[model samples]
Target: MYEIFEQLLSERGVTPYRVAKETGITTATLTSWKQGKYTPKPEKLQKIADYFHVSLDYLMGKNSSLTTCPDCGFTYDPSYPEDIETHIEQHTAWEKAVKEFGEIYSDGVKCEQIKAENRKISHDLSLPLEERCEAQIRVLRCLFSRSLVANSYSLDHVPFDTYVAMMLNNPSYRKNNLEDDLLQALIDKYGTASGMNSGTIYHIPNKSKAISTKDKRDIKRDLDRIMEQLSNQEYGPAAYDGEELSPEAAELFRDELEIALKRLKLINKEKYNPHKNKK
Candidate 1:
């Protein structure tokens, strides 16, 4: 027990004098503990564990395992070679599978959540038509941005201009009068004269600007104001004090705010100080 306790203290670069000073334990008690004169009481053991951010079982040399189970939250003894090896292999495999599944499940959940939010926005007759239209536009923009990222890795996918042209050429898309205007706007922005180009499509509304020091400061100020507005929005009666936007609007606000902040950070790295890499 003393060996393990001493080793832990050494690993943390904490001396007995510092522990005694910080934990309010007397030098006599620490000396007795180090000399193996007697086992510490539960209260004293708890204080030691709390001070060092370790388990009582670890301080007392009862259980040697350092890892806790993610599924069951149980700390298993890894003193035995075979038991520790099998436990590690099983834990690692389970965690890998769970991490992969979680990413796919999270993506599907986000899509479903967006669909539900749009339905709610459309059904709320209290909201003005313009507000509803804006909410839907924000949701579509977010979805389109995600699709662009997903298509970036695929080598066989056609250029974005070609995709837009294909959609515009489709008779079904043409039949939807409302969708035709939106698709036409996209074509005007991204499609080339010949209707085929390798140009990349950017989802952000504003193109890159000359990022001087003053420009970066202005961008930062705008980011701060957006964040403050988002944080001030309340869930109860006070919610009426601020702009009453739907969940989709809040999501779009946060996404755009993040993009602006990242752009500023990149500009600072590439333009302001070319020698240093971004942290």
Candidate 2:
């Protein structure tokens, strides 16, 4: 437990002295923990977990997930659930088949040769452990090669495994939108908010009303003297861009723009079927 704590602290770039200062624990006690001189109580362990924003299970090396679910704040367990075990086993078998496919796609290997090999392997659905392992190697290699192609096209790091997973999960969508140049541009123009935050839709006014008529009328009497003084003077704009935007207005506007763009693009893409005319 002490070793795990030390490792986690080091990984997060935390110093023992800094942790002691933050947690109100003495440096000597923290040092003792690192040296295996003392075991922390439950309360102390809880404090450590809170300070690092990590679960006690992670601190104790019992789980590997780095984040907790925002909705329930439940700590993520890296271990697969019992129900998903069968799915995982099936995926493992698929991986074995992919290995041989990868070998053929290697730089020196001919594409025709690899295609032939893949066809032969595909015919044999009842694969033994040895054949399955070979297939997986090829699949992994092919996936890596495909990701490399994406990386070369765009000067960005694309994880091979992530690409492969996406392809398997949504074959048609992945094929259609494999190398999306618009994604980064969209994220830059509008921000990328994930999960529930991304789902939120907000409304914006057609035109920004600096001050509503009622509010403006109420303030007119107060500013009557100043209004006369400034009546003749030409002011380019308000003190700070026509009155500072409210926090809610800014956040809602931000959310609205992103939601609108994403929604519109998806709708347009779905409605426009190029194959319809041909059919």
Candidate 3:
């Protein structure tokens, strides 16, 4: 029992004095236990067990047959030798996944460990469409699971990758989004951020101006909606369109206003690689 106790202390890089301080047990009592002078009462033993997060029986050698995996915190009976081998193998797999790809931490939806590979996969157009979709979903899942959001939460098919990447990298962006309840509570608390107040964001060109977090989040929300509208195969509205001006027909009028800027190449050449002749 003392051996197991010392092993846990060694594994956690803590000392008996620290444990005594934290658990409110006296150093003298620990010394007495160590010197084989006395056994601690069940109540005291339970406190130590709780601190270490192990079963009291295991701590006291009452369950000497049981073994706990240090990495995965899985406890099982070593007496079941055949099953123990299989269980150990499973723990190895999970431990590797957690260390390599990162798991959601307990505090929030922040995936500090979200790998660059996952981010690259989200936007790499050359990959299979399915792969890209999975990458995006995985990123959100990492966020949601880590943050303890429910499984039914919605991102409304928005490019959450954009918001998530920024949120993770930038403290201001993340705080604003959380305070807005922007992406995590997408379905119940509010609809998708992308579909709300979109037109207003377009003209707010001073995005760099100092503003409150909610204001910044609102601007981000509406901009995403604009991108959504342009890319989707649909048109739905006009601010003053009760007349016979169907928006579909109104769209054709855009062509009437379209003109080739013959100076386009001149501007690009002037800026990028001005021709020797200054074409």
Candidate 2, residues 1-279: lDDT per residue as tens digits? 877677767767888778778988788877777778886777887778777766677566685654433321223242323213323332343344234233213232343355447535633547553454344335434544533322221223233334334333343432433224323332333343221111111111112212322232334334444433333345542122455445555455445644554455445544563332331
The candidate scoring highest on lDDT is: 1
Better of 1 and 3 by lDDT: 1
TM-score of each: 0.27, 0.27, 0.25
Q: On residues 43-109, what C-alpha lDDT tens digit does candidate 3 reach at each position?
A: 9888988787666776887744655555444455653333355455546644553544444332231
lDDT of each: 0.52, 0.44, 0.48
Off by over 4 Å in 3: 64-279
Candidate 2 C-alpha error for residue 218, in Å: 51
RMSD of each: 21.5, 20.7, 28.0
For model 1 the local lDDT of residue 47 reads 84
lDDT digits (tens) for residues 35-121 of candidate 1 = 889777888887887787666776788857555554422244544333344455444534453343221111434555774587467
